[model samples]
Structures are given as structure tokens and as C-alpha cells.
Target: MIKEANTTFPIHPLIKSRWSPRVFADTPVSDEAIYTLFEAARWAASSMNEQPWRFIYAKRESDAYKIILKHLAEFNQQWVKNAPVIILTAYKEKFNSGKENFHALHDLGLAMGNLSLQAQSMGLAVHHMAGLDWKKLQEIFNVQEGFHITTAVAVGYYGGDPSVLPEDLEESERAPRKRLPLNTLACEGKWIEQ
Candidate 1:
């Protein structure tokens, strides 16, 4: 099942092929390729096109990459260090005018989604990691104020044998995916429960 997503997911070739991998092979992700993915994300829809999303990325061996690597918790670093690149997704609330700009993060999500899909289309693996260190991320990159770091993703080719992954992870990888019964989450006319 490790490779099953390539055939599923609502996204076209872009998203259907992406998945989170804890291990990435030792290889270089070219700068131009990353730019192409970001370009696709740059075109995603935004609130009034405020374009709240911002991405800070680092290639595997650069000093900037080291900064990103430091922001990850010990657990994530163990597996992610080998990734060809790590991209941090952020959203700026200063662009909005209200007490609540909930849509800022939503917009960032859309951008990241677009980025991930684009990466997949290029035959790359992108893994979203939420167990990020906020303080380290904010401090290390010197990100401008008001932009909250939402997620960090490890991108590259997957490495390590599935057999070597911890038991639970291995089993989870092998299991068929289960989704909610559509009726439970979606409603027909009147917008009421069935």
C-alpha cells in the first residue's frame, strides 16, 4: 500500500501521487525544480488575492537548510535530515484587516496544497510535518513578524526499507485506507442530515 496513493486522491497526476515519507534518499533537489513548484503555488486562489502564503525553503546541504533542520524536533530530524529539501509554509495575518483573519491560514493551506501537487507531478515526495518547533522556526529564519508558521514539509525521494520502519508504521502503511461514509459528512438539499 505504500505506493497506492499514486492511483487515488482527488487531485490529478499532481496530488494523486504524493505521500508522506519518513525517510528520503540521499539526493539533490535542484533549485529550478523547487521554483517551479512554488510558481504553481503562487497562482493559487487567495482572499482578494492578498496572497498570504509565504514559503522558506532550504536545500539539503546549505547553511539555510541547517537552520531549517534545527527547527524540527528530534524525532523529525532523525528521518528528515536526509531529505533533499525542507520547506516551511507560513501565512501572514498582517495582510488582513480584522480581529479574525481565519482565512489567512486557509489561504496558506491552499498554497501548500498546490505546491505539494506540483511536486508530485514532478515525481517528488512531500511530507507535511506538524511536529515543528515554533520558536526555533520563527527565530532561525528571521521571518517577518505577523506571519505564523503553519507547517514544515520534507521533500525528496523516499529511502529506507519499509520493513525497517517501526511496527505500527509498517502496518499502517500496509493497511488499506478508510474514509468516512460520504453521507455522514455531506448532505443533500436543505443542508440537513439524512
Candidate 2:
């Protein structure tokens, strides 16, 4: 089920096709493909080359998988249960100078952006979620004080039947993708009213 983006400006087919779908197929992404996704993320541009991004991922049926699932909000768990892989993305909260790394979350977003595009190119689907227990996740993974879990990603093929989803979500899953206009999204120098 492809829900291509409705973009105002021309964009790469990959960008148009990349979207976070709630339904995932019960298929296992190959080890090599998974490695390639992370490789793409590893090469994302970082702040001062800090490369603070870190990931903890587990394949389906792994003991760690169950634990990760528990940290997701009940709503996420409903659809994520079918994902073949669940990944936790984290990053350092501060730099070595004890100053806050304002770009930490931005860097994580770049990494995930690379991962998402790569997944789409490989005919895979990736759904990133923020509805997670970040605090409990830190405890579960033994993440240190300097590191913070920022997001969770569910990756797999898109094959789930929307009929099984609750009516509200089913409607959402089938809705046309929407995005802000380019002029509203970006401007020349000063901010312009939409």
C-alpha cells in the first residue's frame, strides 16, 4: 500500500514515496538490508562530526524485542507488534565541554532521515514513533546519564490489512498523505506570513 506524498515542489521519487505507515507486514528484513539501512544512517551529516547518534535494535522474537515492545505506548504496541524490527534511537545530551548539544536531536533526525530513505529504496517501510517510555527505556538498555533515548522506529514490509486496525486508525491509514506548502515551510530571509 503506497501512500505517495502530495508535494508542492518537485522531489525525488524516493522522497515522494517515503512515509510512516502504521501497518507492517509479518516479514523479516534480511540481515544485509538491515545493515545497509544503518550504514546509510551512519553516513548522515552530524554536528561538528560529533556523530552522537546511537541505536539499539532487536529482531522479532528476541528477548530484547519483547522488552522494547513493553516500553511503547499501548497505541503504538498495537501496530508495532507486526514489525520485524524495533529500533531505539538515542544521542548524547551534551558535548565534552559540558555544554548542551543543541543539535543532538537534529542530528538524530538526519540519521533517521537517511535510514528512512534507504528503507524506502529497498522496498521496506519504516514508522518512527515518539510515544514511548523514554525513562524506562534508559533503564532497560542501561543508557547512561549523558545519553537520551529520543525515538523508536518500526521497520518491515507493508502488508498488514487495514481492516484489522481500529476504525479510526484504519481511516487514517487509508487517508491521502498531506504536507505544508513550500512557501509556508520555507522563506527567503525573513519569515513570511503564510
TM-scores, in order shown? 0.83, 0.95
For TM-score, the strongest prediction is 2
Cα lDDT of model 1 by residue, 35-117, tens digit: 99899899999987889988888887789888778778877877677578889888888655645566888888888888888
How well is each residue in 1-194 modelled by candidate 2, as lDDT tens digits?
A: 87888776789999998877787777788889889999999999998888889999999989988999988999999888878999999999888788899998899899999999999998899999999999999997899899999889999987778887889888999999876667776777988776
Residue pairs with backbone overlap in model 1: none
Q: Which 10 consecutive positions of candidate 1 have the poorest summed lDDT? A: 1-10
Q: Tell me the spans in candidate 1 whose CA falls farther than 4 Å from its real position.
A: 5-14, 96-100, 158-160, 163-168, 190-194
- Identify the leading candidate in terms of lDDT: 2
Error of 2 at 74 (Å): 1.3
lDDT of the structure predicted as candidate 2: 0.89
